[model samples]
Target: MLVLFVLAFGLFAILNPRVFLNPINLQNMMVASPEVGILAIAMALAMLTGGIDLSLVAIANLSAITVSTMFTAIASSDPATAESLGGFIALIGVLVGALAGAVNGFLIATVGITPILATLATMQIFNGIAIVWTGGKTLYGAPAVLSSVGQATVGGIPILFLEFLVVAVLIGVLISRTPFGRRTQLQGANPTAAMYSGIRSTSVLYGTYVTTGLLGGIAGLVFLSRNPTASADYGTSYVLLVIVIAVLGGTNPTGGFATITGVVLATLVLQVVQSGFTAIRLSAYEYAIAQGVILIAVMVFDQVRVRRRPRRAPSSQTETIALAEIPRA
Candidate 1:
């Protein structure tokens, strides 16, 4: 993933040195990346559990819509009040995201629904709810302070981008340093073994989906920060794009492994590619085609690498004999 990011960045820099390398354009990329990057992280978490959350974008939009509507309804003309209320409302948006995630978690963990099917169904349901709430129209207006924070920069780095980095780092630490993370990977790697080891699969899965949903909600808030408008249909194309980012980031679809670093680098790679496309005047369709090619190539590469690696031998002679004695299929 790091190699891919470097190569993509170098290629784009070579192709459009003046535009792609410009400070403003680079800043724009940093600003634009968080929305999708957060979603990609959410998707990665789901993928880590041998599952997927198709409803994440829906959850994000729902959260954003909820935030927007609340702001429009209660916003004060007074700047200070509006700003304070906006901060409160934004927290509500994040909580709304967590609530939405809890719903997905319930359906999957409590109801025994497959993650993909459950999220697919909830995606539509969430979108429907958002549409009904907004009458199928975009809700505009957010707190001035929220927009200011969204566009604010410190030491030339976008605050929004810095927020994304913090999120990524925190999640990375969670995965690498926490017991829940260990259980999550173990559950994905082998559910039966994890069960025998006393890791409750249902609990882990529920927590995983809830966390993803929370991340989705955060992404929605980031979206609002950048563009203070919300609609049920916002970021409709992000569903597949985020999945691509997760897969390209070295997440296993069959579960058991994921890397936050990989996901972040992959996010940057896609961002650079998209920026390059705009620099060279390529159409969106062309960019989509390029994404497809990249996904396919990465899958093929992973397959080849897996096949070439040495497999572990049986640790005990008795186990080897048992394997040798087994009937041929």
Candidate 2:
């Protein structure tokens, strides 16, 4: 993120000169961070458990579509209905997200499947449901108040940023300060050891998946609120971004590691680069190349770190010296 920050401001100030660091652009960055940020946290936690949640982007898409669809349905009957039902709409979103997450947890834990395969199956499944719901229609008739949450702010900061902040802080505290969090790390680090030590590995694993699913649902709402429109194609391109944010932010895929703050920083980096791409007139497709490159680099570094920490092999040069110095035994 620091790199992207520097790259964004440096290049933009040099070229655009008048507006790169302006509050407007800064606000835009913050407003844009939530959807990815929310999903990034979920992805980070899931990856920290030695698993992945490919279904999140799909779930997010579903949530966004749900928000838009609900708003349209409610307001279509009586446009003023938003004033009355806005709170209920938000509540429904939370419930839907939580329920989806629980399903994810059950499939991974009790069903005994690899998370990658499990989530992959549901990724398509949930996405398919979103498509069927939308029937290939774009939802644009959102209630005005519901849409405001996306771009609204207080004291010069976007409310969406605050929403993301709340999630980050709440969950960060849960993971860093609580016993459940420690046990999660333990399970991720050494499942056999954690199990032998009487940790409920299945329950923890279930918790992890459900948490991912629930967060993904919330992420979906954020995406929908901000865009205030939905199509079947929602978040289809975001799966890689989700993984990139988590890994770049210092979450270990092999388990027992995560840094929520790092994930936030990583999201900033991506947004910065994305803003730069926008200013430089690069098509969105071009930025996909950038995302791909970063993913490969992050994955390589993570694998190297895991292997280096555990291998503990003597260097070839050190082994040669030991052989040479051996006594006549």
Candidate 3:
């Protein structure tokens, strides 16, 4: 229904004067999707694990700086510099992302730290490291080959979108088909019961964090390629958006469970909604307000549904008491 409204308005406005489906603007929307979408996937996974990643934007910015700087240094004209290092540096960045994910997992699972506090602290630390690494400098002159990931297309679809498809599928398998995923649901359902079942709940919890980190890293690289510039302030706006997508997709914050398709659908809705704000001349603050209102409304609705849902048949004791009162019959 909301999507219908946006489409109707866009169509009416286009008919009246403006052309809404400009190829260039849609392409711009596609380009922007990967950065936010990747973070949203990561955030969704973290939420499924009964946690959140407040440091996702930081992770993306930190990884972006690292990848861009390395690309700059390796692609330099000097002979002693690393040769053809675009692929190598990018690969290393990917692994480092997994490691960062593990760190998040360890903190929350083993160190008894809350996800919010741990991630918040790590967000500052990672962003600070990124700033210090460049000493407030921006990286330029990224290798042409590296930029192709953002600029290239296959069958008229953006490579970033393709990459996101691959990641999303991999995540879907992990959450939907794997034993770890089942155990993760159990953990979210009840930590004590999951532990008693020998599910090694800690491992599953750590895995969630590590996966979030890994996705954040990939998102950073994708962001760097699109902009082809490195800065300490990359991906900040995505933090709330990541959560928005997760919640809109129907992932429970109180428990770590979600579906890939739902998230994909939510992504489309958010993209359209955001585009609507732009089309409607909403200010940045107004857009933020709109997003907040949407999320709060949806969350409340879900809560109400949960409350009104009927549990299994009434307790056995009530049935026994009722039967005794009617024994004469």
The number of the candidate with the highest TM-score is 1
What overall lDDT, based on C-alpha atoms, would model 1 receive against the true structure? 0.90
Output the better candidate (1/2) by lDDT: 1
Please give the TM-score that candidate 3 achieves against the real structure.
0.86
Expressed as tens digits, the lDDT of each residue in 93-205 for candidate 3 is 76767777787888898997989899998888888888888887777655555588789887767888888878889988988899988888778767788889998877888
Candidate 2 least-lDDT 10 residues: 1-10
| Top candidate, metric lDDT | 1
Global lDDT scores for all candidate models: 0.90, 0.81, 0.77
Mark the regions of model 1 whose C-alpha exceeds 4 Å error after superposition.
Answer: 76-80, 312-329
Off by over 4 Å in 2: 1-8, 295-329
Instruction: Summing lDDT over every window of 10 consecutive residues in candidate 3, give the lowest-scoring window.
Output: 11-20
User: Global CA lDDT of candidate 2, please?
Assistant: 0.81
Model 2 residue 140 lDDT? 80
Separate clash counts for every candidate: 0, 0, 4
Kindly provide the TM-score of model 1 when superposed on the true structure, using C-alpha atoms. Answer: 0.93
